[model samples]
Target: MMNWRSAPLAPATASQTASSEHADERIKLSDEQVAAAQIKLAPVETTQLAEHFLATGTIVPDADRIGRVAVRVLGTVTELRKRVGDPVEKDAVVAVLESRELSEVKSEFLAARLTNDLQQTLAARYKMLWESRSYPENEYLKSRLTAQDARIRLDSARQKLLALGLNEAEIEELPNLPIEELRKQSLRSPIKGRIAERRVDLGALVGREGQESELFVIVNLDTVWIDLAISPTDLSKVAENASINVTAGPDGPNGVAKIIFVSPLIDKDTRSAKVTASLDNAESKWRPGMFVTAEIPVPGRGAVLAVPKAAVQTIEGAPTLFVREGQEFVARKVQLGHEDDNQQEIVAGVNAGEVIAVSNTFTLKAELGKSEAEH
Candidate 1:
């Protein structure tokens, strides 16, 4: 065993000479106490502590990939194929609505088309007869005007069906559709995503004038938005497309993500700017609404004196480290600098190559506090 009884004390000023000696007194631990205290020690040394800024945020749905499914026609929902959490395909059918109003529109379209066809034939015949001098010019002109009006009415009726979600193929086939099929409108999803919400039920009355009834909300989870709040002091430290490591609880990141968006508007209440990061959630590890921590590495000023975070102890509101000399653990005041996840840089009152307590520092503080009370 090494001897510390003969070791000389550190030099101090007139005001601190007495207090410093008291603070630097040794912590005498029996072999059993040392084992029970779980003391760990490491040399006070410089370490390359890459700087990082921590910000909190939550995973949210990417706006570009989210879609709200709604119906335009006045109808009653007859069938719902997908429920919440179901995976869907692009242009997939989400639900079916039965509407008498739609059926009436189809009937008007069929009637208008027949009228247009009849008028067209009459106008052609009148033109031929007028060229042959077998019909009057005024009769031909009147027939031509009738044909044009019928054609306009036919186009208007077709457009009304189109606005109700019928494609060109379905519009073309509508004239021949059976009465039952003509009234059934299938609500289709516009994009590929998972069903996030279901707002309609079977036999539910839906669709109103000047408004659309939302049936399902689909969201693509392949990519998710990380909604982060950056404080005013840290706003400049983070920027668009900066590399980030997101973590769950205290663990390391599940995967790397990049800052995609940063809001210019600062929140009045929190005094923080909104920032966003896009992460690949193909494996679905980072799910929406899950709170996470984002660690962004910023440029460091330069190297400085540093040590493991565990080496520092809070004794009477001051940061202190227990230095080891010849088996003696002495409390030493320390000044700290830039810190990150792994290390804390020591600015003053500690020198390189000195052994300091790295773990179980609370035990040393408690022991020192008891001795100080006794004195």
Candidate 2:
């Protein structure tokens, strides 16, 4: 990288460095004036320009976070607490029910618990009697067998209560509650989320049966999916785990998300595959159902000599760059190469370490045009 800041170039060599312009086509502005115009300068160097593929898609609810909530026991809603769009915590009760069927289940559990206690007591007593020779061996064996039968029945009853949405803690508390409170069951959300839907109304009968069985739909919108549609032509460019930037619209929500899913199969009609990314939306600003434009970076071909995109100015239909020469700025046209959103490669006419006008290149271009017209 040679410094382009050496002695002032003669007319012949200066023209050779530019795009076939006269040897002296130049624009000279003072550093103070350049600062006033907000013109900025940067050194040209070889840079890797990562290409990108643009696609449009929509934000959707994370499928993993959406929950379909229901109760296992048949019940009638007696007290409805939550409504659609209401936020809920994990295990938060959404509705209370008065279930006659549940009363029978609780009664069965209670009876089995009592029987298990009695049988265990009997088993202990029989073992004691046999060990002390107060009871015959056959008699103790009979009592032990009866106790085992009662124990098995007790375990079956506890399992049945569990299947009916009773957790171990609830089952333990069941024996402490009065019979009247035993039938009172509540439907709770298993996850922390907003209630997306409420399928049951107050006094509505709910059971473990048909489609109406599901009572609530809870969704965690903190993290969501942005589905980017990739055309088959660009399918080879998109891959899983690639970083993508998504914007809903100008002045709307925008976020950086990583591509976590790329569909293997393409839609027959649209001929496009769905590429998905996950973005954190803890603020709930990026709502579901929002259409978003995604910029997915395509892998680079290789490293090349590049310049800032802002440094290149269109002069008389030619891609011209202002090369810094001593105290003056010389307008030089350069061959262009691969370009991306931020940087464009300089295929020819410019070398690494050469200083160029990065900001306000238009003002320099106008001055160069005026200089040429004078000839």
**Candidate 2 at 210: error in angstroms?**
7.4
Report the lDDT tens digits of candidate 1 across residue range 85-183.
999998899999888888888889999999999999999999999999999999999999999999999999999988888777777887677777988
Q: After superposition, how far is residue 330 of candidate 2 from its true place, in Å?
A: 4.8
- Candidate 1 wrongly placed segments (more than 4 Å): 1-50, 118-144, 209-212, 250-253, 299-375
Q: Give lDDT tens digits, candidate 2, residues 1-375.
A: 222233212232454436545645665555655666667888888778978878999999999999877777778888889999999998888988877788888888889889989988998999999999999999899989998998898899889888888778888998899878988987778889999999988888888642357899999999999988899899999878888888988989888999999999999999999888999998889988999999888888888888888889888788989887765687788999888988998889888899999988887776566655555
Please give the CA lDDT of all the candidate structures. Answer: 0.82, 0.83
TM-score of each: 0.64, 0.84
Q: Candidate 2 — number of clashing residue pairs?
A: 0
Clashing pairs in 2: none
TM-score of 2: 0.84
Q: RMSD of model 2, in Å?
A: 4.9
* Cα displacement (Å) at residue 33, model 2: 8.9
Candidate 1 residue pairs that clash:
none
